[model samples]
Each structure stands twice: as structure tokens, then as C-alpha cells.
Target: MAPSWVNDRSYYQEDCPIYFATDFRQIRNSLSHADYRRINGGNRITLSEFYKQYHKYIMLLYQNGRELWSIQNIEKIDLGDVTEFNRMIFE
Candidate 1:
């Protein structure tokens, strides 16, 4: 079964489009406290937990529409080792 947030269309509308984050940690940190409360019931959670809960909806919009795509799948990666590989190569 899909998560409740996936079925809840209230967060996705013409004026309030869903935001996508390629790096789950960055996006999770970017969310305002109110957003966290609204979507996550005010419980503090790790980025992996957040991604496990929301990645489906993010992927849905990414594959179907203009929303940005984040990591294809959530896997265990060392937070300290995460660097912008693209920037190093492209810059």
C-alpha cells in the first residue's frame, strides 16, 4: 500500500506544487518546521525515514511532470561522504 502522503492530494495543487529534492537530506532539511508538522505529524525523523515515506510521491511527479528528480532510490550512504560529484566534474 502507498503512504498516506502519496494519496493526499491536498499538498499538490495548482498554486502549491510539490517540491522535489535530489538529495533527500538537503530537501528534508529545507522543509519548514510547519511543513514537517503538516506532513509528518510533528515527529522528528531521520532523512532516510523521510525519504522512505515520501519518495513514491516525489517519483510520481518527477516521472510524470515537471517536478525535479532526486535519487532514484533511497539507500544507505554516509552523510559525511556525500559531495556534489557533478560540481567537481563540471566546474
Candidate 2:
């Protein structure tokens, strides 16, 4: 029985455990209040939008010491496939 947080959602599938580290304050300070609201309080943005806004912070697996199966590109990522690959590698 997986936890509720483990369930799939429109934003991201839970099968792959995504991880990222960033300076929240820096990101927040860079955005205007309205921009923040548009990103965080409105309908989800498309993959193109995501790449445009966050590509600088993106990192794929093994980049910057990230573990295997890490995802950097949101536009072409398949979380389910990443999860299965991770399971095969670790098991």
C-alpha cells in the first residue's frame, strides 16, 4: 500500500523519485509578485513554459553528481520509464 503522495498526479508521476536542490530565496527574489502568483497559483504551465523558465537549473542523471535515472528535461521526460529503469538498476 503506497502512501497518498506516491500516487500519480498531472504534474508528475510518483514512480520516479525526483530530487533537486536550489536556493528558494534567490528564486523568489528574482520573480515579481505577479509572476510568482502566475506560476504558483494558477493553472499548470506547459512543458515549453517549464523549460523556458527553469532550464538554467536543470540537471540530468549523473550531472553534478546526481544519481542514475535523474531527469532534467521536463519536456521529454517519462517518469514511469525512469522508475522502471531505476528499479532494474538497483535491484
Candidate 3:
């Protein structure tokens, strides 16, 4: 089954991954603070089960991180607007 979060249909935008990161953080907190069970649409799952369910999204986030890290020659990269650049990179 496809991941529940992929419904957004905004893959390449900065907001898409930001939403995924926030949702993943929430899942992490729920697992940590609530008996190690992930709460998903009223369905509770163990850590391993959670990983199986979200493996695709997890891998996508990992790949995005790798791509971000692969950026070289930061000074040579031209960002037209500092605010937009910060929003894209930091927000």
C-alpha cells in the first residue's frame, strides 16, 4: 500500500518534504512517549511495523538528505533572494 502522506501530490516543492518531516517528528514523539506504539489513524503499530508501513517515505527522506548533503561549492550557488533561499533551505 502506498504511504498515507503521499496524498499531498507536491513532491518537488519545499513544503512537501517539510510536511513529511513534521509528520515524521510527530510519529517519533508518539512512539517515544506513548508505550512505543505509533498512532496511525486510530491504528497503533509497533516500531518495526511502523517502519514497514513507512519505509518508502523514510527512504525518500533519506535520499533527500543525501541530495542536500551532496551540494558542493556553496559560494558559487546563486540564490536570488536571501529570504526565499532561507525559506527553501531552513523553513
Candidate 4:
């Protein structure tokens, strides 16, 4: 399956956070607390089922993670590039 981040050739578009964050929360909870359920809604799904749903989007998650890492490690904040920065963040 195609990665989820590329919606209309852009990132941070439709369903971006949900496509990654929900699965991350589910897996994190499963590993840390043995809470294999929907993180927000209290619905339950087996780990296998969660894996089936999540497997396809792994690349999406990885790409977003890398983007976040790059942003976090920035050495300087150039005010001149505010527009680009805003697009990177708020878009």
C-alpha cells in the first residue's frame, strides 16, 4: 500500500495524525501497560488485528518520525524562513 503521508503530493494533509498517532498509541499501550485497546475511545482490538490494520501504514509513521526528528534537531531558527517553517508545522 502507498504511504499515507502523500496526500495530493503533500504532508500533514487529510487523516495524517490519525493514520499514525492512533496506531502508535495502541502499540505503546500494548507494550507498556498491556492495554490492547483503542487509546481514545475505549474500544478493544486484538494485537493481531491491530497489526493487520497498522502494518500498511508503517512507512507513514516512519516518515513522520523522521520529519519530527529533523525539526527537533534544527540548530537555528531563521525568521526569514518563517513561511516555510509555518508550512512545515501548521500545514
> How many angstroms is residue 53 displaced in model 4 relative to the true structure, after the best TM-score fit?
1.3
> How many steric overlaps does candidate 4 have?
0
Q: What is the model-wide C-alpha lDDT for candidate 1?
A: 0.50
lDDT of 4 by residue, 18-76 (tens): 54566666666766784524344356545666666665466567777787646543445
Cα deviation at 29, candidate 3, in Å, is 0.8
Q: Whose TM-score is greatest here?
A: 3
Q: What TM value does model 4 have?
A: 0.38
Q: What lDDT does the true structure give each of the candidates?
A: 0.50, 0.45, 0.58, 0.57
C-alpha positional error of residue 74 in candidate 3 after TM-score superposition, expressed in Å:
1.2
The candidate with the higher TM-score, 1 or 3, is 3
Q: Give the per-residue lDDT digits (tens) of candidate 2, residues 25-83.
A: 33444354446444453444434555555443453323544644454444454578765
lDDT leader: 3
Per-residue error (Å), model 3, residue 52: 1.3
Per-prediction backbone clash count: 1, 0, 0, 0
